[model samples]
Target chain A: MSETMKAAIFVKPGEMTVREVPKARIEQVGDAVVRVVRACVCGSDLWYFRGLSAHPHNSQIGHEAIGVVDEVADAVTSVRPGDFVVLPFPYSCGTCPVCRAGFESVCPHGGYFGASQAEYVRVPEADGTVVKVPGSPEDYDDETLASLLTIADVMSTGYHAAVSAEVRPGDTAVVMGDGAVGLCGVLSARMLGAGRIIAMSRHEDRAALAREFGATDIVAERDQAAVDRVLSMTGGYGADAVLECVGSRQSFDTALGLIRRGGVIGRVGLPHDVEISAEGTFYGNIGIKGGPAPVRHYDLEAGLLDAVLERRIDPGRVFTGIYDLDQIQAAYEAMDRREVIKSLIRF
Target chain B: MSETMKAAIFVKPGEMTVREVPKARIEQVGDAVVRVVRACVCGSDLWYFRGLSAHPHNSQIGHEAIGVVDEVADAVTSVRPGDFVVLPFPYSCGTCPVCRAGFESVCPHGGYFGASQAEYVRVPEADGTVVKVPGSPEDYDDETLASLLTIADVMSTGYHAAVSAEVRPGDTAVVMGDGAVGLCGVLSARMLGAGRIIAMSRHEDRAALAREFGATDIVAERDQAAVDRVLSMTGGYGADAVLECVGSRQSFDTALGLIRRGGVIGRVGLPHDVEISAEGTFYGNIGIKGGPAPVRHYDLEAGLLDAVLERRIDPGRVFTGIYDLDQIQAAYEAMDRREVIKSLIRF
Candidate 1:
């Protein structure tokens, strides 16, 4: 293996370029090195590109990718060389108390799965962080690989939102967002047996994908008007539960208002400037929960992977654009312009 | 049957005095007049006497009492003249959607039982707001009646804190206040089958009551140290659930830090300067719920009142000071100075 490899780095605002950086190795007790096969551009990736978050000066970027295990430390188990695997975003030691409790995304000794938009990634706690693909990575086409990438982050997050909100059979649910994660929330709510899924979407293309994923209705209204539509739709009460796929002050407040006397708002979107009225939530008996999705813990087990493999649900339909790994910059720009739902990058 | 009556009002900060005011009349179709027999000083009552909340100039102040029905409107079907009852703190009409969903505290037409501190109160939505105390007003003694008074607010609120947190058998519950409500929380935790109850109490006397009320342990430690102790006790995790009975910033944050993954925090204390990190809660799988307790919905049927009436629990022991109605000023001063746990006023 070469000592150096190409990796994507964020140089300045709205500018990303690739450069040769030191390649990853099996340094830790449970580490494994994997050769990248596919990576995906996330809506949250724009947070830094748009100057909404702390910028990294020539620092590695990206956290979702699928790969083939190339090397492993002696302590690493459950994965071997040449095995296809899905890299869990935000590496976690599965044996830790927090991970055992199912919050693998915030494992105490864990760190982000950054620099995965490169030739290889050194995943810590490899036995816990890497899930083996059922077959050879070459068996799946590029689009199918992109679909598998969703399992590492967005799809698992949507399932977390649905499960946290306690979306049950015969229940009606409302999803707040039109991004890839929100569309996946529509799929998850349907899979959870939600009788009706109402998605709060503004764009037509994503709205179409939401319907393809089983969204029964789409309301483009925002703020109080959106709350009004939801209330009126459920006979002036509201949906049985709400999936806060958009983590904004306005979206959080609207989700709070949309629930009836007692309902839960499952949130997975990263939050900023989130000020909540304790009194407002108390009176409505609304329960808000969700953080980072323990995607690795859920991926193959939550029926998402099998459903995708069996062609039961088309989670890959979220990919509206595709590019080579060197074209990551253009891919992000297109997504930022809302020209594509999401972009897939082949390694 | 003359119109004039003596009532307690907040004449000014640090000055709660009794004065002659117009007596309550059956003004609405669902209104009923109650002649107060026993009223207790709530720790929250000092919100104004201590100059915390907006002090109303000569306005009604109390919201918890056991009283006799002096008169009733035609629509008052549940109680009649001479019937003794427990008045729900938030007067709910019991027919609103929120009320039907079992949260009467936030009923659209509801208001606080403010005039209960005085000799009489006009209860709106009489059938829905008043619960018959299972006997005549002359049946129970002053102390038992005072105990019944806890059903209206404090005990119900404590039960709310426990229930909202989903206190299950064999679970560890931590109460965050040492006042009347906090003491009641200790009792309620036991009733809910909590195997161990830890109270955050510093005062020896209050701690004694907490122990008597079923607190298995007392941790006078505050802030991070308290959280550390709780985490250490639970094997580096934290308590299964926490009851936030003191709503200050420090206590709120401490309670937030004292729960293990997937634990719930039930809060009932009036909050000020409370800030929560959304990221912190989501990552921990923590759910927080509690506001105004729907005492009306829980009083007669949730088994709180029956538990007390059956002598299975004594919520009235929270009263460590006894005074006549004329000694209301002394009552307020004692609570403010921490001289008494709580005070009961007999008419």
Candidate 2:
């Protein structure tokens, strides 16, 4: 293996470049070096690429990926070299009190994944964060790989929203956003047995995807009009639960407006310019529950991975565009231009 | 009985007055006339009295009271004339979707008590809204009356906070504020079996009441110090749930700071100038869940009134000052001056 490999680096706002970087190695007792097989651009990456987030820290851009374990630290017991693995973004020690509570995203030693469209990536707390995919990495088809990749971030995030909102069977659930996370939220609500899934999508292509993902209705309206639409659909009452996949104030407002009394808003999107006032939340008797997605190792523990592996759920349809490592920048540009819902990069 | 009675009306900002209004009579089929026996000033009422809330519509002041049934319309089946009852503030038809969902505070037909520190009140939806005390109006003494009165608003609101946060037994809880609701929260948390109930009270008298109410610890510190104290107590992990009884931004911030990952902040206080940003809430995996207390018919349904009657929780101590109805304005002044945590006016 080459000592240096090509990896995507977020140099500054609105900029990401691919260059040969030092290959990853098992640096800690519970670490593993995984050779990248599939990686994807996330909706949140737009926060940096669009100058909404601060300039890059480490610059290795992508945080969601599927790979094969190339090396493993001696103490890592969960997986072995040559095993296919899904690297969850927020890597952490599995035993922390916060992680034990199933909020591993905010674990004690929590940090981002450096899987950034790279040839190789070092995964910390491998025993807890690296979810081994069944069979070899090469054995999985492209659709399965893409579906599993969603679990690493957006799919699990959407699932977290559904779970956080406590979407029981036969619930009227509204997913606010047209992005991958929102589409995945529609899929998740269906998987969670939601009776009616309303996708708040204004775009044609995204709306089509939302419907395909099992959205019963498409609310193309915005603001209070959108609220009225959902209320109208649900017999002048709003949804029993809302999945806020868009973290902006408007999306939050839509989520708040979408829920009936006693409903919960499963907030997954990274919040920006949004303030949940007590006046807005309390009077409606609405509950705000959810934060970042607790992907929880993005493994069998979440059940979605197993669903993807089995025939239970097929979330692969969310990947509207696909590319190779060499086309990393173009893939991001395509996402930035709204030319792709999400692009999967094959290594 | 006289055809007219004296009642308090909010005349203007910073001013309230007593007026000889027509004694209430059952107007709605589901209505009952209640002669006010014991009425108390609420912390939220202070918002109107202190000119923080807009000038009132009905001008009827007090919303928390224990009263006597003077008359009942044909359809009212819950109580008859001379029966003692607690008039929970937000009188609503219990069968409305919002009410049936247990959020009567915002019920469709919901309106203020019309209790207004008055001698008589007309309670609409009496069958669904009023709770008959275990005995006649003459049965309970001053202490029990005061304690039961707390349940109509503050105590139930406080309990709602604990419930909204899903405060299970053996969990650590924090109560913010030294007002009646905050003190009630401390007591309610105790009743809920919270292992450690921390009362954030800087006032010596209120803190004493909090401690008497079963607060395991009292953190008189403000801001970060208070948060640090709770964190230090809980091994730097913060409480499992927080009861926010102070609606200011600082109190909301304190409540957010006091909860660990997966903890809920049951926000019961009437919010003022407080906006809980998603940025502040989501990262901690924290949830925001309270609103105005539903009061749940103010009794056996709420479980707290029964708790009070059973002598398991004594919230009467929250009534630091007492007066007769003739001294209503003076009572309001004293409460406004912060000379009393809460004051009860006997008719």
Candidate 3:
């Protein structure tokens, strides 16, 4: 086997490079090393790429991946070598209080994967973090593999939005962003039994996808206009639940204005400079439930993988552009310019 | 038969006077005139007394009362003259979308009972706002009347905190204030099936009341000490639900620190200059649900009145002082000095 691997490393603002790096090895009793099959870019990555947020120079990049396990330490009992697995964005000790409570993403002992966008990656807490696929990666078609990759992040995140909002059967729900997560939020709301789904998107392509994902209405307006449109659509009562996929001040303000008096806002966009007034939420009996998506919980505990294998949801459509490991820069650039909804990296 | 009556008027900060004013009468088709039987000074009333919040120079003061229906417009059918009723702080139109959804406090057509502290109060949307007691106020003893008076505000507000927190059976709950509402929150958490109740209070009198109201433990420490104590008590996992009866920034901070991952904070103290970071909440999968308590919903719709009459809960114990209408100034002064948990005015 080769002692070196191709990996993407963060160089600085607006730059990432693919270079030959040391192959991942089992470093702890709980660690496992996997040869990457697929990985993808995330919207949050743009925060650092645009210099809106800082990224450490020369750090291993990427957090989402699916691969075939090549090595596992003795303590890693969940998966063995040659096993196909999908990694949740963050690794967790499944026995921790937080993971036990189904909030694995925030487990104190857990953290993000830093080298998933590489030929070989080391996974800590492997027994608790990675979900084993039913069969080898080659058994799945390209579309199915793409869909499985979503289970690592976006799809689970969208489902978290719906779950957090407490979307009820036959209730009106709204999605506040037109990105991959927002589109997936529409799909999740539908699966959760929302009777009427409204997707607020200005992009035609995204809007069409939202409709396909079960949105009953499309709102192209922005800010207060969007709030007014939703209110008008719901007979001035507003939606019962709102999925805030864009963690912007304007998005939160719009959410505050466009929900029914007793509604909730499920925010999963990784907030950027967002401050919510306690007084503002108190008057409306509004609820705010959000955070990092517990992808491991959704994938293993909530049967998300089963739903995917059954073809119940095809979230891979968000992967509009595919690239080889060498095209890492182009992938980030295309997503930053909104040229593609998301970019998938094939190993 | 009286054309004029004495009402407490807000003269300025630290000054309230009983002055002769026109007696309350039907002002709208949905109005009812309530002859005050018992009214109380609330913690919120102290906000203006301390000059911390603004009030009109001579507006009728107070928002909580239990009274006998003196007169009603022809269109008011819920209560008739001579019927005893508990006035929820806000009067809401039952038909409004907000009211239908059980949030009467923020109904578009609802408002506070400004003259509730007076000899008579003109209640608008009476049918939707007042919950009729089985008989006249004379039929119940002083203790029952005092408890019923609490159904108007504090007790219901406390219940809102527990309900908002989604306290479940066997869960450990924390109450963040030692005021009447927080004490009642202890009772509410117990009623909601929380196995362990921790009250964060400093005063001996309030702590005693909290225990009587079903607090299993009390943490007299403030700020970080309180947070640390709670974390230690719950095996370092923190409480499952925290009732934020104090809407200060410090209380919210403490709540954020002491809640277990996936836990919730139910705040109902009428937030004063409080702000929550969305990023902070998102990481822990924390949820915030709060607002003005929907008293009418709890009283009529949820059978809180039944619980009071059945003696299942006696929240009246929070009334540590009682005074005649003529002693209004002393009532406010005693409460302002923290000499009483709550002061009741008997008319």
Model 1 Cα lDDT, one tens digit per residue, A267-330: 9888877766776776666777777887877775566777767777778778899988788799
Clashes of 2: 1
Candidate 1 chain A: 10-residue stretch with minimal lDDT: A300-309
Name the candidate, 1 or 2, with the larger lDDT value. Answer: 1
Model 2: residues with Cα > 4 Å off, grouped in runs: A9-17, A50-54, A74-77, A138-141, A297-302, A337-339, B9-19, B48-59, B74-83, B133-135, B139-143, B297-302, B333-340
Model 3 CA lDDT for position B8: 88
lDDT of 2 by residue, A128-181 (tens): 787777888778788888888888888888888888887979888999988998
lDDT of 2: 0.83
When just chain B is superposed on the true chain B, each candidate scores a TM-score of 0.97, 0.94, 0.98
Ranked by lDDT from best down, the candidates are 3, 1, 2
Task: Answer with 2 or 3, whichever has the higher DockQ.
Answer: 3
Strongest candidate by lDDT: 3
- What lDDT does the true structure give each of the candidates? 0.85, 0.83, 0.91
Measured with C-alpha atoms, the lDDT of residue A293 in candidate 3 is 92
Evaluation by TM-score, superior candidate among 2 and 3: 3
Top model by TM-score, which number? 3
Once fitted onto the true fold, the runs of candidate 3 whose alpha carbons sit more than 4 angstroms away are none
Q: What residue pairs clash in candidate 3, if any at all?
A: A291-B282
Between 1 and 3, whose TM-score is larger? 3
Model 2, span B190-249: residue lDDT tens: 877898888887788988889988898888899998888888898887888898888888
